[model samples]
Target: MPERTETSPAHHGHQRSPGREQLETATTVFALLADPTRLHLLWLLAGGEADVTELASESEAARPAVSQHLAKLRLAGLVQARKDGRRMVYSLRDGHLRRLVTEALSHADHQVTGAPWHA
Candidate 1:
């Protein structure tokens, strides 16, 4: 076998932690947002905090499904939930996440057509 070198491409200027872990975190976040239901939920939550029933009604998804998606989003740190009496209200955890989602969607729309967002 060839002798391992500290300057090999695999280790060249790489941090102790693998880049793949960061990529995986990003991929997980994107994957959670990829679902149409989840995207709608995020859009609604972007306005303010809402419970599962409200999210389901706004997104046209079943209550249980919306709850499940919210759970995943919470796990990813993209959203937060608080207990209000008998219901759990969810909201965006980071304001930057909201901006990122909006910018990405706008970019995707622009890519599909030549028109850009005026507002």
Candidate 2:
């Protein structure tokens, strides 16, 4: 894999163009949430942690399908898993992720409804 580099221009003591970082981060997070299965998985985890079987049942998706989405979320660092006896329970890694998702959704809703979240 190519070595990841910080592409954004730097400032005095902080990264410049935070909007750029927000957009990039939002894009990645949105991409992860794009799939219905993954979204459902997130919703489930929003309530609490669950294993593959639990998530599959809650999402009404096949085990492999749920596992696939979980893998992607894990790879994205959006979700973390812990072995609970024989099952691996997954949960959202960052509390900010929930806010990010909520804010993005609110923005979209506002755009469609012509009631912007920001003035």
Candidate 3:
């Protein structure tokens, strides 16, 4: 394990607590990400904004499904959409989430390739 630095809390932050509501909200978000389609949608949005047609084509999911997934993500405050004429352009709402999706995918790649995990 990596050594804890001055910035690091000696123990898990959870030990100090973020309050039940905050933790529950986080778990709910994680539950949303547990869905493969939803996770894919997030990963795609992290790259940049795209419309439903583009996201459907790139994700290889049905257009309706992509829209539905986007709706769920949007409601969760994970993504944002803006009207671009008749099209709705979507993107990840923050850089932290972008990095989270990227790191998760990288970890997934390591698992699939039997690569050793690194900290």
Which candidate gets the maximum TM-score versus the true structure? 3
Evaluate residue 104 in candidate 1 and report its C-alpha lDDT on the 0 to 100 scale: 72
Between candidates 2 and 3, name the one with more favorable lDDT: 3
Clashing pairs in 3: none
Query: For model 1, how does the per-residue alpha-carbon lDDT over 1-119 read when each residue is reduced to its tens digit?
Result: 45557855345344455488878987888888888888878888878899999899988899899988998899889999899999998999977678667877777788889786663
Assess each prediction's global lDDT (C-alpha) against the native: 0.82, 0.81, 0.87
Residue-pair clashes per candidate: 0, 0, 0
Q: 2-117, model 3: which lDDT tens digit per residue?
A: 67665574453334546799879879888989999889989988889999999999999999999999999999999999999999999999886787789889999999999998
Worst 10 residues of 3 by lDDT: 9-18
Pairs that collide in candidate 2 are: none
The best candidate in terms of lDDT: 3
TM-score of each: 0.72, 0.69, 0.85
Q: Candidate 1: lDDT of 32? A: 85
Which is the winner by TM-score between candidate 1 and candidate 2?
1
lDDT of 1 at 118: 66
